[model samples]
Target: MGEHVRAGNLDIWTEQVGRGPEVLLVGGLGDTVESWQFQLDGLADRYRLIAFDNRGAGRTPMPDGPVSVEVMADDAAALLGVLGLAPVHVAGFSGGSIISQELALRHPGLVRSLVLQSTWPVMDPYLRSWARFVRRLVEFAPSERAFLEDFFLDIYTARAHNDGTVDQFIEEVLAFPHKQAPRDTQRFLDAFIDHDTTDRLPGITAPTLVLAGGLDPTARPELCRSVADRIPGARFEILEGEAHQPFQEIPETWNSRVDAFWRELAPVT
Candidate 1:
């Protein structure tokens, strides 16, 4: 069973999984906790997993206000307080990475090791273009599914390598809480588009693992490298032949890499 939380004035919804040290998994723009399907099972085997829907997404209950990634990070910290867990390992992807970076920088005691995949800590050309692309789709597209079908072709490497995955992704997208609410989707997108934490990266103290796809159109490897370079002693790696969704593109490799990072950080028995 799960419930809602009140972080000062902000509201949030969070779910906990497995048991050990807590591992918080944050989703990207308008994505639900279901997006972390790749990391859930494997990570659950080794540690507690706390996956939460960001404010204005899922069942978090946002009544419409300015939503900043830093404000969302505050929600994450509040969620952990409600859960009674501290200094947990945190993992985030894409839009989620923005929150993760803020969480570590602003609430250093609330984060242990970090896994940042297919993302950067700051805004870039990719984020700006996609914000317009999605807005245009909502405004002028003849068919929403057709719009996503084309959009995926450009962002996700899996579309070309495994067409079967797109069907599942579409289903997953539909299941998201804001899927049918354009205003809510736009708010989430706005928060993502405004995400720029370049000046804040030097404050991130958690040991970090930043992964990027060699061909990812959105969060390129160079951007990921910039994140790693900023974080003290953070490790950066690129998975060959993968794009925005490496965990989905090469599950075995992606899971293993994440598992290894968590294990390496865990205290010895």
Candidate 2:
């Protein structure tokens, strides 16, 4: 079950499961706790996982005025402090990864380790254009289903589309009760496009693992590599045959890889 917890100025909706080392799972733009469903189910047997809806997404209400990456990172930090879960393993995907980078830089003592998936250190022209296009779709797309159908093309591979995986995902999103408003979605995308942590990533002290998808168009391997290159001792790998969200597309493989990385840091006794 999920409940709203008082974190900072907002009541952040969070869900937790399992019992072991604590792990925080952060999702991408317009995502909620439900986004980490695969991880919650796959890794819960051996680890305690906490997943939350980012501000301006899901059941979480957006605060007044604009939201930035730093603000969102601070929200995560505050949540940890309130929950007494500091120094926990943190895993972030896509836009969530950008927020994770800021969190590590701002609250080094709160993060034990970081697993950044489909991340980038800076938004290049290609990425900026892509962000803008996504925002435009949010503003002008004919309908929610239409927007998702068009947007999934960049995130999923041809195999997923051909095999009806993307179709099922779209249906799930449609069925979900707490849908993100188009304006809020645009705001989240805007924040992502404005963020740049190129020089600051080196300041992160947490053990970090950066993973990219071989077939991802949004955050390509080169962009993801730049993030690892800047962070000292951070390992980078590409999940071959995967697209932007291998966690959803190939949950078994994704869960195993992330679990292995975490286990290496704090081996079972």
Q: lDDT per prediction? A: 0.78, 0.93
Candidate 2: where are CA atoms >4 Å away? none
What is the TM-score (0 to 1) of candidate 2? 0.99
CA displacement after TM-score superposition, residue 90 of candidate 1 (Å): 0.7
TM value for model 1: 0.90
Estimate, for each residue in 1-269, the C-alpha lDDT of model 1 and write its tens digit. Answer: 44666666666766666777778998886666766766676666667788877876777766656777778888899888877889888888888887888889889999988889877766677668867778677666677677677768756775553767777777667555455356776777777786777777878888999998998877889989999998889999998788887776677788788878877888523
Off by over 4 Å in 1: 158-161, 175-180
lDDT, residue 88, candidate 2: 94
> Over the stretch 1-269, how does candidate 2's per-residue lDDT look in tens digits?
99999997889999999999999999998989888999999989899999999998999999988789999999999989899997999999999999999999999999999999999998899989999999999988899999999999999999999999999989999999998888889888888886899988899999999999999998999999999999999999999999999999999999999999999999843
For model 1, what is the error of residue 16's alpha carbon versus the real structure, in angstroms, after optimal superposition? 1.5
Residue 52's lDDT within candidate 2 is 94
